[model samples]
Target: MELERAVGTYLRHVALERGLSEHTVAAYRRDLDVYVEWLRARGIVDAEAVTPELVADFGAERASAEPPPAASSLARMQSSVRGLHRFLVREGRAETDPSGRLRPPKTPRRLPKALTIAQVDDLLDAAGPAPGSEDASAAQPASVRDRALLELLYATGARVSEIVQLDVDDVAQGDLLRVRGKGDKERVVPVGSYARAALDAYLTRVRPALAAKGRATPRLFLGVRGAPLSRQSTWLIIQAAAEGAGLTAHVSPHTLRHSFATHLLQGGADVRVVQELLGHASVATTQIYTHVSVDALRDVYATSHPRAR
Candidate 1:
């Protein structure tokens, strides 16, 4: 069958019979379109003429090509082609699926970077402004907002999005915060005394001045125009704070989250409980930090023991 005709049939099957999402169908279409272009350039007109050897050759070509695709991208292409061939086989249009044995190129998983507890303390303390100097007015410095944000983020293990979107009502005394995570799921997390103090200062002094330009919008963290802070802005805030903290550690908002989880685990919190606190869908997702902790122990054993190598 012609590539065009077979692809049309496959798409109809995907959309109507299999009920695949539009985004997924679009990705499959893109992958198959590339295949069709390759076939046309080589003067190959029929799907039945395709072979596993040819498919394997194409995989190799893509792997060695300059600006080669990442494993995730290659995996998506393989999935799309495999699905198409499977469809053709089910209809008895092809003897076998040429794309069945394709494998994606390997991609190394990057470890999450975490801040040490002392480094975290230094970063948070360094977040606010330098006192006894600078600026025109008697207003509070911008770091007041950033200090509260970083403190709250570390204290509650709240996502940057959640922190930026939080309101005055979200915080309560006793160092507890009511955090709404992804998919509107809510969990109560303890905000350390430091976070509470930063929050108190911001609410009492800094936030009011920042919100002086407009009516209260119920967002605790407000921009100059009194709107709720955006996630991007929140990230920029963390990045700026990381720089100002003066120790060169490649830090991001997630680094604090990882630190929170690792510190909790190091202090003997159960892995399963950490999963629940982080709002992870499964315990497996939270197990990576345990691997980090284990590696640390091994390093200590290797270095400190007299007979260890």
Candidate 2:
């Protein structure tokens, strides 16, 4: 079968039948498009013409390009190519899966960047009303909501998607938050007192005001128009708070999450407990924070230890 036609079929299958998200489908399309172009350049336009060596060469070429793709991008590209070949074999369009032996580029495991406790405090303070504001009523509802959102993110270590997907009823007794994580997995995480207080203020004072601007929705966080807050908006909230705190560095929602895990580990929390709290599928995934804690310990030891340097 023609490579382009097979690629189109596979993309459609993944989108309509396999039920992949639009973002995922787009990524597959992009990666496959590049793969197909490379194959065409090599005079191997038929799906059956694709070979293991050809795919490996393509990866090597991409890796050797000026300002070569990062390990993560290379891995993603390789995955996309492998998936296409697998689909071709499964559908009998190709005699065999040429990408079966393909290996993703090894990516260095970078430690998660976490804010110091003082820096986090500064960020949270910036998210709230300025120090010594005489009347809380003077604060915009959106400002109040942003503070609550930031607090909830740091407190629960919930992904931005999970936090924004929260419904009004998700907060249970004992300051517990019912979070729906990746793959629709639900886990209950406790909200710290600070987060709970912020949530109460937002729910009682600000959320209703935002909700009144449009029809009611079950979504916990809303924009000024009462529409559910988007992932992009949540990112912008973090960025704004970081800027307000005079933090020139990039700040993402994941930064709060990294800080949450690292701080917990520094406080001597177990990795297993953190895995459960962060909704990580494996303890191995949560173990990265241990490295962060160790790095911090080393830094302290280097600074404070009496050993000869």
Candidate 3:
């Protein structure tokens, strides 16, 4: 089969049959586009014409490119190419997989950055007054919504993409929130009292007014113009609040997620339970937070102990 056609077929398979998310599929498309172009440049346009040496060469070239890509990026690109060839072989489009011997470079495991409890409080307060505060009733609609948005992000430790894609109906179950994560997988995460109260204020006091500004949307978070809040918008909201709080640390949507996981582990929540809340397919992914907790312990011990340094 032609390499381009095989890539198109594999992309469709992952998007439709395998139930991968649009974002993941788009990434695959991008990586494969580069791969196909590289092959075509070498007069190798057919799937069967690809060789393991050629695939290895491509990996080496990418690794040595000007301003070389990050290890995670190279690994993802390799996975994309590997998946394509494997799919082609399985479907009888090719006799052998060219990427069989192609191994992704190992990326360094960087511990996630999590804010302290006091810092989280400061960030949330910077978003707006809490739901029951004396000035809460007089806050702007956007401010009210920001408070709820940040609160939910920290409370649930959900990916910002998942949070932004949420619909009003997803939270209709009172204390339980039905979150649709990557691959359209659904998980029920409990909403804490603080987030619930913040949400209540947004839903009752702010959402209605915002919804009336534009066409009706079932989306839980809306922009000032009333469209569903986008991931970029959510990032901006987090940045604005971080700045208002006078925080010097870099903060993003994922920072709240990291903080949520770290705080839970520090408070003695089981790692397996945290794994479930995080919707990680494997507990290994969730265990990284344990390292973050251990680091915190080391820091405390270093400062508090009377032993020689």
Winning model by TM-score: 3
Ranking by TM-score, best first? Answer: 3, 2, 1
lDDT (tens digit, per residue) of candidate 3 on 155-257: 9999998999999999899999999887778999999999999999999999999999989889999999989999999999999999999999899999999
TM-score of every model?
0.65, 0.85, 0.95
Best by lDDT: 3
RMSD of 3: 2.0
Candidate 1, 1-309: lDDT as tens digits: 887899999998987776664556778899889887876787777999888987887778777778978878887887777888899999998888998789876667656678889899888766774222242134355777777788888877767767776778889545778877665677888777777877877787778878887776888898777778887787787777777778687778888899999988888899998888887878988898887787678877999999996
lDDT of 2 by residue, 61-122 (tens): 98898898889988999998988889888887788998888889889999899999999999
Between candidates 2 and 3, name the one with more favorable TM-score.
3
lDDT of 1: 0.79
Q: Rate the local accuracy (lDDT) of all candidates.
A: 0.79, 0.87, 0.94
- Candidate achieving higher TM-score, 1 or 3: 3
lDDT measured at residue 154 in model 3 versus the true structure, 0 to 100: 97
Task: Give per-residue lDDT, candidate 3, residue 286.
Answer: 97
Candidates 2 and 3: which is better by lDDT?
Answer: 3
Which scores higher on lDDT, 1 or 2? 2
Candidate 3 — which residues are off by over 4 angstroms?
295-309
lDDT of 2 at 13: 86
